[model samples]
Target chain A: MENKILEIVNTVLENRGKKAIRKINPSMSLRNDLDMDSLDLAELTVRIEAEFDIDIFEDGIVNTVGEIYAKLNIK
Target chain B: MNVLITGVSKGLGLKLTEVLLNNGCTVYGISRSLSPELERLITEFGSNLKWLRYDLSDTNNLKTEVFKHWIGLGTPIHAFVNNAALAYDDVITNMNLDALENMYAVNVFSPLMMTKLVIRQMLLHKIKGSIVHISSISVHTGYKGLSMYASTKGALEAFSKNTAREWGALGIRSNCVVAGFMETEMSSTLSEDQKNRIYQRTSLKQQVDVESVANTISFLLSDESRSITGQNIHVDCGTI
Candidate 1:
């Protein structure tokens, strides 16, 4: 599951011409560590919803990688 | 300001393109074809006007194509105008399924899909964007053989009102500009008697100016209408 999340995140970043993250740390903040802007985060949200068929935002803003996993687990 | 407007090849769309360019806006237009007037505007405005010619009925691939094109611009879209519409004038009984499906695809679904993308772009850039949906006074008043067309505009007005509610916290605004009968190709089908009858019902007793509608659109797109949203502003010369 972590690997899938990492792959999706990296692909979306690369598609946007942003640098891909080397690793997905649970504590890693998306804005700070991944250098993802709000648009990037929004795209990530969309990708996540499509892949998992779950809305991450239904809970709230997922600021950290761990929060994304947590929401996935909850779903 | 950067604006993305659909249906820029003729009539109200062309007038809108001209008005936006005259106001020094970098306009990105989408339509089925670039008309001669649009070509003239491109020549006059230089790089201020950019356009993509694609049929709005091709809704499935529009998001990816439009977003990719928007990224190439290297700027955030400040305003988005969903002005393209399909005029399917028919009574409930005479409406064909295939034709109605195609009409809904262009009129309702495409604009909703386009709005989703534009809102994403606005959210990503932290831009408090303005969205204006061109509706019609027919939505507010009754007319023969206009039920189908009026329904689509009604859907748009409802969508605009709710969208304003959904995105208000983000400072993004949405509104509908309801226009009256105009002297556009869309209205050219109306006979002289039909046109006169409609015009006579209006307080102004004249066809609504396409340029005036275009100018109102420009105003809604600007910060001047910053406090305005979730409302339908009528430009129908008091027809409704």
Candidate 2:
């Protein structure tokens, strides 16, 4: 699940012409560390929903990679 | 081209569906009920015309029911026509809250939600999609007993402009076709005198042709109008 999330994050980054990250940490801030804007976050949400069939940002704003895992119940 | 259009059971929506299909484009049409005309078109077009019976009032289930389950993420929607609308015509003094909310749900909220999902689909597929919202000249001109209905269209026009501005960088164009009064079921309730009075307001002094509005929508959806976005193209008969 973590690796899949990493891939999705990297996809969003690459689409924006940003460099892909080596690893994704739980504490990593999506907006700060990954440099994702609202539009990028929307893309990420849709891609994540397409893969997991769960909308991470449906209930509330997801600011970090850990919140996404929590939304998908990965823990 | 693959287009998703709402209110395909009748009026401008039905005409637009036919025009798009005639142009060799696949249509995913949504309406609350299946009109016989739309049914006939489905039979004639076969796989090219996909019909779904959906009430736009239920904005909550749109993503699941219409987008995911019906159209599917695999189908790349190249364009979206937000045409379905509920006209709760009443003077401001006689306004009913329930009816107003219901109209807003169908006319404004549903289209807004659909636009969001459609843009997301475009983003996923990396497609430079077009979005056209069907607006009304009533939004521009003052019409008695059309305040509530026109308000919904006004909101849509505002939303379209903002959507175009926000998504233009990604090549996703958004626009509104502000149509004049047409001789469709939507205007069936109006008396001949009232209809004529409305028509006289336009320079042409005749009912706006439904075909013309549909063709304008087609042009907006095609690459022919690639440079046109964030615009309210008035297809009204030069409404003064």
Candidate 3:
């Protein structure tokens, strides 16, 4: 589960083609902490939804991948 | 009508599919080469709609998107609409080869392949169908850095008109609806100046009305528009 959050942050950070996820914590906000934007958020939502078969809203706010995994109760 | 549309992956295409199905229509669409979005819609709307996963611009996948199924049904297709497009900005000299190539792939080749496949289906069914190619006003007005983007629509308009003329005897009418700027995902990058210019030129001085375009497409697809062909009908509130 922890690894999943790390992977999410890593994928977002890699959007800029650099390792922005070098250091992250559970309390991180994808936008505020890593400089991710709405499209990044949307794409991440789709990825998680597809991977876990869950539903996500376009306006749904998620601050961490742990929250995403918890919503789906995935291990 | 058994209408087939492309770019139903999201935005207008997705919405269009939803509207058509809600009104009791069987439709087909393509996106992402293939994804669960189609299945989600199918679960809601029933299996009357089948989606093909193929990119319009990739010539290799043309047959897949166009002819994936329907052969088994053996019914003449009712309508075929090309609703997907790709666009980005680059000043002529500084443009990257990759970006330009991608635009042509989505904007030009994909629609042509889609049309070719749909026409074949129409021929097999011996049914007269109308095709609506979603075009852009960019084909007429010049933007500072949109030469590549505009040219693709221009090519599509030309193709749509000629194909309509050539197939007149075949009873397949081809028409283009030149869309103005809409609140689509694609226009999220526009600046006020760009949006302003588009609205300012219009007699109504407003953004493109999506409902009106939808109505126009439906009309063309219906038998009411049997006489219209080889035309680029502007839906831009008179941006022309």
Candidate 4:
């Protein structure tokens, strides 16, 4: 599951021509590493929710891959 | 003849700026950055165009920024084009909430807020002005992933008509231009075949370019279109 999370983040990063999500830490901010602003995060969350069929936008969680994984019990 | 166009740095906004300047209208091209292409036009237009570096998505202070820009112009604006927008394609059942929020903010709220501020400026200066909200065909046609994008534009057009009604007495004319899918950098993401399919749906079966749309907008601002207001003129190749 954690690997899946990494793959999703990497897909977005790849599409955006950014570095791979190399260092994964629970505390890592999506903006800092991903160079993603609010729009990217929003689209990422949308895609993640669709893929997993979960409701994350409700709580405003799933901000980062770590948060998403934690919420989805990926770790 | 100061004209404000949000997202004036690139794509249709850049083209509109050039077209307006060619018509001898001073344009205040508002965008986050001045593209080299815009710089070239500015150099040639020489005082007919000025670029404003401000992000419309920064909703917290968009109205203030717009007011500041109007003040800086030293002349009342003759027209405004709310041309900036953002799009993300996803199913409605699982649209990105954050993206949707920011999308509506930039596409709908920012333009609405800017219009209010511009009306205030016009009222203060006791000047007559025309405003055009550049809407999209997405407002009427349903697209698989364009729900959020289309909704915001629909909202803008709705608000524009109401504004035109409300401001008509104040010498402020507001109208929306429902533009068909144009051959723009924004559409460059699509394959040629994909673009061809989209163009086939238009009545003319051709993609409208920025110049065609800009000409209509320039007409709306000029006295030639003075009697028109609260109209969503379809520059959409006769598409419904």
DockQ of each: 0.14, 0.87, 0.01, 0.01
Instruction: Report the lDDT tens digits of candidate 2 across residue range B69-184.
Output: 99999889999999998888878999989999999999999999999999989988989999999999999999999999999999999999999999998899999999999999
Off by over 4 Å in 4: A1-75
lDDT of 1 by residue, B87-131 (tens): 988788898989888989999999999899788767545689999
Write the number of the candidate with greater TM-score, choosing between 1 and 4: 1
- TM-score, candidate 1, is 0.80
lDDT string for model 3 (B35-71, tens) is: 4665688788877777777666677756533564433
Interface RMSD of each: 5.8, 0.6, 15.2, 18.1
lDDT for each of the candidates?
Answer: 0.87, 0.95, 0.74, 0.77
In candidate 4, clashing pairs total: 0
Instruction: Give each model a TM-score.
Output: 0.80, 0.97, 0.70, 0.73
- Where model 1 places Cα greater than 4 Å from the true spot, the runs are A1-75, B70-74
Q: Which residue pairs does candidate 2 place in steric collision?
A: none
Off by over 4 Å in 2: none
For model 2, the local distance difference test gives 0.95
- Report the Cα lDDT for residue B56, model 1: 91
Each candidate's root-mean-square deviation in Å?
Answer: 6.8, 1.1, 19.9, 18.5
Candidate 3's C-alpha runs over 4 A off are A1-75, B33-41, B64-66, B69-75
Candidate 4 C-alpha lDDT tens digits along B96-158 = 789898888889888887886677556445568999999988888776677778888889889
lDDT over C-alpha atoms for residue B230 of model 4: 96
Best by DockQ: 2
